[model samples]
Target chain A: MELLKPELGLIIWTTIILLSLIFILTKFAWKPILKGLNDREKTIAEALNTAEKTKLEMAAMKSQHEALLNEARQERSLILKEAKDMKDAIIGEARDKAKSEGAKMIEEAKREIDNQKMAAIIEVKNAAGNLVLEVSEKILRRELNSKDEQVKYINTLIEQSKLN
Target chain B: MCEYLCATKKRVIALKVLKFKLFITIFLLSVFSVSLVSAAHGEEETNSTAPTEHNESKKEDGKFNAKKVILEHISDSHEWHFFSYPTGDGYKDVALPLPCILYNDVNGFSFFLFNKLHHGAIDGYSLNAEHHIGRSDGEGFYDLSITKNVFAMMISSILLIWLFRSAAKGYGARPNQAPTGLQNLMEVLVSFVRDEAAKPFLGKKTDKYLPYLLTVFFFIWINNMLGLLPGGANVTGNIAVTTTLALFTFILILTGSRKHYWMHILNPPGIPFGVKLILVPVEILGIITKPFALLIRLFANMTAGHLIVLSFLSMIFIFGQMSPIAGGGISIFSIAFSTFIYLLEMLVCALQAYIFTMLSSVFISEAIAGGHDHDEHAAEDLP
Candidate 1:
């Protein structure tokens, strides 16, 4: 068929049209389109890089925050341990002070009781001695009524004691 | 989880059922339309032939030439023919006559509408039986008219320009903003060409030849798409068009070639002198065949696709000549097959464009790749 035949005029026209298309499109279309595409690609790559960096930063910050929290927890437990030890020491000192004061009061009471007992014994002894002396005085006064008879009897007794 | 799986399974079943229903509906509709069209054709043939028995004999003489019909449909013509309908006495051709510009040595140049040639002759120039313009004595003349294919090319180019210009404007308007509509689509294609086609082969030099690659890709792709439409010219299917495209690639490859490339072709390394004699011719042939293959591959592929679809459509008429019922039954299958081929052609449209661009870039890069390694080696030796 004539259709299979490539005509010269059509070939020339096609070449002209294609060349013009290439030239025109290269200048107006593909240039800008490619530039825009490259720009977008670069932007996307930069954005992804920024996101990765930020993610790393965020992870670092998160670990740092956990470390700081751990430090605060350790400090809080240490402070709690110190506070407990101080409270125990204060309570023990108060108990020891109270026990010493009770012991001192008991010693003072025992000394006072001993002093009272000695005083009472001394008073009893004085009273007994006075009573004995008064009895003896009365007896002697009653019995020495006859002075001569008594003196004679004493002389006879003294002579008999010298002969024997 | 069980619940969710059950819900998903129900949705899948529902979707399958819906798809089956849609397929059946389309099948029935196609069959119905086929029968209706065959019936109308049969009636028209019978009615027209009954009035004039002599005309019937003449019609039988011509009969149905499928090859001619298919070729005529696929070939570039002086006019764009849409579907014609039967009028009062005969079928009228519904077509747009393009301008015919012819030049010859004697008459110098002639300009007239293509419809003028339909009357047999104009200004000593006449359209041959094959619808080619020549001298009345049947001498070959140069035709520079805007035929169907050329018009299609112009239209496709204009469309490409408009589309990309608008897309470029969109990029300018919104520097970093997201693209919408045409800009979005153009960006995807542009990026695909840049990233997939040009970058891989051209490497660092992709920017240098990216414009040509992009233009060729979009031009071929757009023309292929246009060829698929009804009443559209087979722009990409024509050898002239493909040759022009291949010529551009050939030119680029030649112009971009470095000294190393010529050296490799002339005196290849690692080959004995006796072997070099055989290898050099083959290498030179290889150079010519690269673009030749590009030309033939695209032309043949696009033309074959169109031929296959046209053949499928032709089947309906071929079977209809046997019997109306046979025609009607075949029409459904033929139309279905053609529809499938049409969808496949859509993929081929983009694929061929991509292949052409990628191969062109590969060729150019190969031509320029000679001194690149030398430079790299030199740089390594330096530092």
Candidate 2:
């Protein structure tokens, strides 16, 4: 028990030092350190806020990029459609022009055929009259009639030929 | 214009004269009151038989029946002892055992040594076999007397409580609020603790333990400083003080032990069974060693400071008996060295306290965070 006295002294001194320190530090030192800590907290918060805002902005930019991509796809599809429609229209117009030109050429050929038939009939009548007159003259020569009578026959033949 | 100026100057002179007279009167009154009170107290101290009577009562209480350490030191010094109201002459004579009269010798008989069981005095001093009674005279000044050490500790605690309470009430975080008197001093101390001590050890938890750490820091510092006073109280020089503090640390570490902490200490992973067996004992030893180290560090620092001071002071006495001239020369150098050590002691006092508290907090934090668990071994064994 007597040996423990030293331990008691140590305890008492420790208590005094502990109490005094608590008093001194709480009064003199805590505020500034606390303030510094708070300041650090605020700075961290600000940094977090900035990071959040940047994240949002990046998200928005990504969406905008997606919209642009969609627009490009739509534009490409529209251009392809427009090109196809233009090609079909041009083909239709060309087919119509070819049909009209073929019809006009057929009508002109029919008109030219009618004119050639009329001219051929006139030429055939002239040639038949010439042949009959030549045949009548040959038959009269073979029968051997008098000179006066031959002259009269030739005139008659011409007249008959003209009547025929 | 000249007439007006002269009139203003005359009025100013009159006011100054009145202020000077008022100041002188106030000063004289304060000085007179102080002197009167002191004189009254001095007379009372001389006339008071109360101390002797209290000392007799304390003697009856069975304190210091054994070799009284405080008395030993004082007696060795051969100085005249006196007592005040709280501790009168008899009360002073009635030696208070270390640790608030928790334990003391029976029969109220003081002696140099007693041989009860062993039937022989070890080194001509009383021997208690049950208790590992190592003398401070051997371990140095810090281990000297328990009562004085505890007194110093208590005083330091009171000082801390007072210092912080005032600061907390007076000033907050507002700038331009210049700290007046003690408040200014307190603010500086707080800053030093936060920046220098608390910041490094505890980091994020630094803020949580700021108040406690600061309390410890100033308390230890002030006591260490007080120990260096002329009479050489050497409260910090006691091993018991450091041991109690270390015990507090040990308790904190155990209570705050986390799962991870236990795993690391008891069943460390990535090591073989054979190695672990070797390591387990060592690890357990380490746990005990932490507090032991803390005790030694604080005890050694405080004791060293006292020894240096005492050694220098002893030169004055030692050489003074031989030759005054040689003694005077030695004392000059001694005083200079003592002053320098005193300044260092002031820092060490605070530093040691901070280190102890910081390490304690870290230990507790590790435990409370579930750092260590015995079940970890079973979990690891499972396929």
Candidate 3:
């Protein structure tokens, strides 16, 4: 029976208490609590977003670095190939120039040798003529005094030069 | 996908913490409320006047009025009565009388401490054995007096203010840091009610109704716990308290109701004319019954919990009246069973508070679900 009687004072008091409590809590407690919770939530979300962005950026930078290295590697190989080709061309040109110069020098030496040989032969002939004249003069001196044979050899050479 | 799954795993952990925290709060709130009662009981013990000698009167009669004692324990009174003690000569009834305020046609407002009427009638006002104040002249008057239940509420209300105010200050003092102590307790409960109770039903409109829901939840929760303490007022058990709580939900439902709600109630869609005639009245009845169910559920659960506990305690005295030996033997059973029952009641306190708040949000959501216009707005919002 006592349980059934929902007292009037209690009802009114409960109404007043609850209404005021709602007002006060809504104003003071729930507002800030909710706001703080929301702010924290926003911060956490932002952190996760930044983390994801950083991870993507890092991956992009890694790929970009790899691409730059590959370009540099290709450029290096191309420069090496060009240098090898230029070295081979320069070496071939130098060898050809040296070979032609050596051939020309050998031809010039041969011509000089030929000229000297000719001069030597002419000298030997002159000597040989003098030697024949001397031998004939010796034979004539054996026969009749040296002065008369020498004059004979000189006269013979003079007549031969005039005929020529 | 990884990120979403991680978030879900975090949410599950967070929900566990919330439940644990809410558990601490109600349990701690009971202890806190009981401490207040202890202080009051101590004061009343020193201040209580001794009754005229009824020394060992019950022993002489060998009769223990278990029903009267248990009912009085569960009911409200004009004063806070702790217990009765027998001295060598007389017995002592420790009670703190409250100020009585009444309104009648003859007397607009009369005020006095309930102790004034302790001895006899005062100014034609008399207190019945049931602790109701009535006029000797047989005139009905409004009892605006601060009864025991009222004082208990006042204490809890003040405590509520202090707690939440401090929590609000914690929010100000520390904006984004994790909650600690009382602030943490309040936050967990607030979030729980928001997420588990309001958000599930009210959805985006959760913030709009969170305050009222939180208030009623904490009110019922704290009061239910307080009532479980020895000699605490059965505030939530009282039908009046639950009715008032229900009235708040009913008002919210009625006021926040959109046109579509009434249309659905008055003329449910896709129904024939004959079916509409039958269904409309049932739908209207449904509106009233929603809150009524909220009221009765909380009131009955709280009242029954107290009743079972009190009945268990009464068993000792009942068996003691049979024989002192039987009483001594059964006390272990009574106390052990009652302790187990008491723990069960503690859970029911949380359960009842939860049911009341959840059901309330459900009703409010039903009223405020404004129909397909929201979907149309969503469609219109697309590029």
Steric overlap count per candidate = 0, 62, 0
Please provide TM-scores, in order, for all candidate models, with all chains considered together: 0.73, 0.47, 0.73
Task: Please write out the lDDT profile of model 2 over residues B1-383, one tens digit for every residue.
Answer: 99999999999999999998966764554344344334334444553543332232212332212223232332111121233233323223323233212122322322222112124433323223322233322422122233444444556556656666666554454333455776667667667767776666555555556666555556566767777665545655666666766776687677656568777789988999999999988987888988888778877787776666556555544554344455555555656677788788777777776776666665555554433344564365355
lDDT of 3 by residue, B261-346 (tens): 99999888999999998999999899889999999999889888888888876776676555555555565566667889999999
lDDT of 1 by residue, B324-350 (tens): 667667777888899999999999999
Model 2 interface root-mean-square deviation: 6.6
Q: State the lDDT at B287 in candidate 1.
A: 95
Docking quality (DockQ) of candidate 2: 0.16
**Candidate 3 or 2, higher DockQ:** 3
What are the chain A TM-scores for all the models, listed individually? 0.48, 0.44, 0.53
> Order of candidates by TM-score, top first?
1, 3, 2
* Residues forming the 10-long window of minimal summed lDDT in candidate 3 chain B: B53-62
> Which of 1 and 2 is ahead in lDDT?
1
Give the Cα error of residue A137 in candidate 1, in Å. Answer: 43
Question: Quick one: ranking by DockQ, best first?
Answer: 3, 1, 2
